[model samples]
Target: MAKDIPAVAAGNQVRSVAKALMILNLLAEHQREMSLGEIAKEMQLAKSTVYGLLATLRDFGYLEQSPEDGKYRLGTRLFVLGNVVADSWDVRKVAAPFIQSLVDELGETVHLVVLDKGEVLYIDKRECTKSLRIVSQVGTRLPAHCTGVGKVFLANLPAEEVKSIISTKGLSRYTKNTITEFHLLEEELKQVRQQGYAIDNEEIMESLRCVAVPLRDYTGNVCAAISVSGTLSRFEGDELESIVSLMVRIGREISLHLGYRA
Candidate 1:
């Protein structure tokens, strides 16, 4: 379902609340600092109106002003909100031990990720004992098209929403292997949905390989993904297939722990 932006107040209460939120949403989507004029242009609002709204949001700690560039971005309020949302998920707690176990058994990095808006948010991660490793920390957010967990999540989204996200997010190339074309990514997602798994073949980082499986909720809704990542040298053919199978089993186990029936 599409999220409803709050109704704009009419008549005397036309305080530009809707426009202010639109600006915030734009900034959030960009995931980068934006200047007041840039924000005004993007929002199609008067410079004065954008400035006033930004000032109000800054005063309330909902937006932060950078000292170096004087651009604004999401503030401490978002961090607080993110923490609240992260903590509310009982699945994170239930899956942490299993994630650790997977890391120990496979000797590779294991991660649990959930879709937040159009981005993939890493909720938990376990590091392997290998001397050399692929380092992905918890709380890291990445573009859905560039990572295994994100692709699996994207594979489960409605077609229109998938198009909407791709249109808005833009397929950024993180590495030479990254899928930067929308049509290619759509085809890849179709394969992922059909196979019930996704792979990141050095897309996000050079010489890294990862396999991911979706975690379904009680309603059979794809709610999260579990992945194992390591250097490319360690994953190939049977070894790669083994990790995929392991991830699928672990993912289903975690999903069942979260009350998933199937």
Candidate 2:
């Protein structure tokens, strides 16, 4: 057998990758956003070289910039990739029983969706038996501005990024109830961020209403969202609040099961 490599020798084998990992570790330890200058100074690297690495990381969603200070912080994609790595524990499997219970309780369709390039991608659906139920298939992608689940994802993003996404995607009206104007959408999203949930309010489909709650990870970042969608008649007045409360509770419970401590 060949002689065992020394620990230092083994570690030095991939110096570039090791340095990249060191940068990530430094960012994580900082526990706050860092500017490009800050990161480069900490890494003792050339500005251009650090820029290339940061650009690559940002493009891959491993990092994101804060609009307030133009500094970089951990991105939502890291939480997403973490969930993927934790698939042995499996978010879908952990969430299924709760989702099934909710569908039974509410007698409405339930959806689990994740944010994708500022859009919402439906990954799973627990169908309702009602003949008039909303028909959404797994793997369907919808604009983030008008849907309940989509709003939950957007509300967690920084304000400038949110504005950029809307400006690029431009709120194509699906219904009169949709928040088409940037100012109106901005106000509602502020409310959404504060409330920890969002409402569709017949915005996507007339006479259809939805309430969505953020599904968080151990880092307390929203990796996905769960939503309940059904007819307006079922969501009128006090019933609407009731449904939202139930969904929020379910979301929290699911978050706890997904290794979120609080």
Clashes of each: 0, 0
| Predicted candidate 2 versus true structure: per-residue lDDT over 150-172, tens digit per residue | 88988998889898888788899
Superposed on all Cα atoms, the candidates' RMSDs to the truth, in angstroms, are: 5.6, 14.1
- Overall lDDT per candidate, in order of appearance: 0.86, 0.85
Best by TM-score: 1
- Candidate 2, residue 140: CA error in Å? 0.2
lDDT of 1 by residue, 1-262 (tens): 0123343443443346767677778888899999998987787767887899999999988899999999999989878987898778887888888898898899888889989989998888878667246656787889999899999989999999999988889899989999998889989999999998999999999998889998888889988888888888888989888888888888889889888995
lDDT of candidate 1 vs native?
Answer: 0.86
Clash total of candidate 1 = 0
**Deviation (Å) of 248 in candidate 2:** 0.8
TM-score of 1: 0.70
Candidate 2 segments whose C-alpha is farther than 4 A from its true place: 1-89
